[model samples]
Target: MLKGPAGALHVDDGGKGGVPVVFVHASCGNTTHWAAQLAHLRKRRRAVALDLRGHGKSTLDGGGPISVEDFAADVDAVVDGLGLQRFVLVGHSLGGAVTTAYAAAHPDRVVGLFLLDPASDGRVIPAEQAAGLMQALSTDAWGAVIAEYWAPMLAPSRPEVRERVLSDLRATSQVGASAGLGSLLTFDPVTALRRYKGPRLTVVTAFNQEPNSYQRLVPELPSMQVDGTGHWVQLDAPDAVNTLLDGFLSSTT
Candidate 1:
C-alpha cells in the first residue's frame, strides 16, 4: 500500500516515532538486503527499507529507460508518500548514487547520509572493462553473477554467511537484476555527492575493492574502514556497521 510516483513502493516499516531512517540497497538487492540493519536500527528509530522500482515486490507503471534520476525520484516519491519530513539516508553501492541524487535534489530533507562502499563517477570501469563484465554475465547461463560480485563483501567469520548471501540474491528476479544493472552502469554519483549539503559518511570495505575515485572525490569527507567486509558491508559485518551507524546518526542528530 505504498503509493509513489511510478506506483507502489514495496517497503517494510518499523519503530514508532523518532527521525525516520531509510535504507537503500545496491543494484540487484531489495528490501530484504537490509534485514540486518533494519533489525538493529528499527528498535530505536523509525526505519524503512524500500525495494526500488522493478526490484522486489514494487510494481512499475510503464518501465521506461532507466537512469539515476528515475531511482532518485522513486525514493523521493516514497518519502512524500509516507509524509516523512526529516530523515537519514543510508545507501549502498548503486543505492548510494540514488541517495546522493535525492539529497542534492532535496538538501533540506536529508539530515545525514551514510554510504556503504559507494560507487563514484571517477571510478567507473573503462568501457572495455565494463563490456567484458557484461560479456561475462551474458556467458554465464546459470548466472553465477552474485558470487563474482559478492566475494569482497563477506566476512571470513562463518561459511553460513556465504550461503545466506547467495540465497538472498537468488531470491530476486533476474529481470529486476538486469533492469537495475542497466541503471547502475550509467550512474556516476561524484557530481551528485558534491551537491549534497548534509553530513556524509562513507564506509569503505577492508578488501580494497572500493574505487580509487572515491578516495579522490571524498578527500575531505570522513571515512572509516570496515574490516573483513566487501561492498555489502552491512551483510558481512552488521555489528560493526551498526556501531558506526549509531555513532554517526547520534552525532548528526
Candidate 2:
C-alpha cells in the first residue's frame, strides 16, 4: 500500500520489471478489481492497481471535495511514488475519465491509454433515463447494485466475474460512488480527449460502443470491441481483453 494525499491506497505492485502499467478501477471498485489483468500481465511488466480514495483500503471518510482533478492527482502520486517515468495508464468506467485527464495532464509520462467502457460523449440520455440511472446508483444499492446491474449491464456468460466485481463494489466507500459519478456530469470529455495524442485505445463491449467523445479521435484512436461482455469487459472476457490489451501495449511501446 502507498500513501496518497488522503490516506493509504492499497496497491498491488509486483511482477517482472518492464514497461509499467497502472490500473484505476471504476467508481465503485477497488484494487482487487484488476486482479486478473495484473496476474496475467505481471510476468512481462510491472503491473500496479491502486484503490482510489474512499475505495478499498483507502480512506475517503471526511475527506475534502472529490473531483476529477483529485482523482487524476491520486494517479499522478502513484506514478511518481513508484518512480515510473513512463507507463501504460488503464482506466475502467469513471476511471477512464481519470486516466484521460491524467494522460492529458502528463502526456510525457503516459505512453498509452487503455480506456474500458468509459463514459460516452456528444449525447445525454433523456431525463427519465438519467433519473433511473441515478436511482440504480443510489448509495442504498451499494450492497445490492451488483446483482441489479449484472443482468442489465454485464454479460450473463460470466457469473463468477460479476460476483467478483460485486465484492469490490460493496467494499467501496459510500462517498466514492457519488463523488466520482458527479465528476462524470461536470467534466468536459471533448476537452480532455483532445489534450493528449499518445497511442490511445478505447475498448467497449459492442461494435460502435466506443464513447462518442472518443469516436471523435476516429482514425487517431484505435479501438476494439470485446463483446460477450459488459462494462466490466476485463472481468467477463479476460482472454479477449488481454489479447487486445497486449497488442495495444506492444504496438504503443
Candidate 3:
C-alpha cells in the first residue's frame, strides 16, 4: 500500500523494465478493472494499477468533496512513490479525466496516454442538468439513478461482466461517487487535452460514440471505436483492448 493524500492506496505492480504503464480505474472502480490488461502487459513490460481513495482497499478519511485535482494527486503520489521517471498513463471513465489532468500537469513524464471509454466531454452537460444529477445522487434514489444511467452502457456486455461492473459500482462509497460526479461537472477536458500534446489514443464503445464526443472535440485526436462492447470495453473485450494497447505502445514508445 502506498501513502495517498487521503489514506493508504493499493497498488498492483507486476513485471519490470521498459516504461511502466500506470492505470487509473474509473469512478467506483478498482484495480480489478484492469486485470486483463495487467496480466497481458506484465509478460512484456511493467504494469501498475492503483485503487484510488475511497475505492477498493484505499481509505478516504475525510468524506468531503473531491475534485479532479484530488484524484490526480492520488496518481501523482503513486508515481512518485514508485520513483517512475517516465510511464504510460491509462484510465477509464472518470479515471480518464484523472489521466488527462495528470498529463496536462506533467506532460514530460507521460510518454503515452490510453483512454478507454473516458469521460472526456465535461462541457456537454448543462449547469441545471448537472445540478439535478448531483441532487439526485444525494437522495435515496441514488442507486436506482446510477443503475439506470449506466444500464445502456452495459447492454452489450456479457452477464458476468455486467455483474462485476455493477458490483464494483455498488461497493463504492456514496460520498466518493457523488463527489466524483461533482468534480466532473467542472472538469475542462479541452484545456487538459490541449495541454498534453503527447501520443494519445481514445477507445470508445459504440454506446458512447456521438457526434460531439471527445474525438470530435479535437478533430486530430486519434481514437478507435469498438463495437459489440459496453462502456467497460476492456473487460468486455480484453483481447481487442490489449491488441490496441500493443499497437499504441509499439508506435509511441
- The candidate that wins on TM-score is 3
Q: By TM-score, how accurate is candidate 1?
A: 0.87
Q: Is candidate 1 or candidate 2 better by TM-score?
A: 1
Q: lDDT tens digits, residues 31-131, model 2?
A: 77788899989878789899888777777646445777688888888888888899999999888888998998899889899998776652355567656
Compose the digit string of candidate 3's lDDT tens values, residues 1-253: 9999999999999898788999999888999989999999999899999998888888887766788989999999999999998999999999989999999999999999998888857667888998899999999878678889889888889999999988988888887778777788778888888899999999987766676577878767788888888898888899999999999999988
Cα lDDT tens digits, model 1, 109-222, are 999988887765633667887666656655544248656666655645457767766776676655556556656667666667778868998887655444454546657767
TM-score of 2: 0.86
Q: How close to the true structure is residue 75 of candidate 3, measured as C-alpha lDDT?
A: 96
lDDT of 3: 0.88
In candidate 1, which residue pairs clash? 152-230, 153-230
Which lDDT values do the candidates have, in the order given? 0.76, 0.76, 0.88
The alpha-carbon RMSD values of the candidates against the true structure, listed in the order shown, are 2.5, 2.9, 1.2
Report how far residue 154 has shifted in candidate 1, in Å.
4.0
Error of 3 at 83 (Å): 0.8
